[model samples]
Target: MAEKAESLDLIWEVTEIARLIGRTERQTFHMLQSGQLPAKKVGGRWVAERGTLIRFFMETAA
Candidate 1:
């Protein structure tokens, strides 16, 4: 489905990132604010690359 392609995007919003990692937006925002996730704030919005998140979780899961 086209929905799956969202994960292939280079930039993702907090909600998207939350879904990717199977967490809630509140939790994802906390992780981003605490520097637990590799991301940056641009134009007052949180953004992250799907690949980076995937690899980060993959590595952490090991």
Candidate 2:
């Protein structure tokens, strides 16, 4: 489905997620390990949804 394909693009690697959130890799990893970030460990790598991260920051920024 088109939605499925589009969803694929929403998945971001840890590095990209860190840059988007303006945090260093170490900080991002720490947050991920502590369950502070809206991400999950997939296949031994941290993966996060782009929109979810954006929305999380937007909501929390208020």
Residues 1-61 of candidate 1: C-alpha lDDT, one tens digit per residue: 7887655566658988899889999999999999999899998888888788899999999
Cα-based lDDT for every prediction? 0.87, 0.84
Clashing residue pair totals per candidate (backbone < 3 A): 0, 0
Cα lDDT tens digits, model 2, 1-62, are 98886766455567887898999988988999999998988888888888788889999999
**TM-score for all models, in order of appearance:** 0.80, 0.82
Clash list (residue pairs), candidate 2: none
Q: Lowest summed-lDDT stretch of 10 residues in model 2?
A: 5-14
- Lowest summed lDDT across 10 adjacent residues in model 1 is found at 3-12
Candidate 2's error at 40, in angstroms? 0.7
Error of 2 at 45 (Å): 0.6
In terms of lDDT, the best-performing candidate is: 1
Prediction 2 global C-alpha lDDT? 0.84
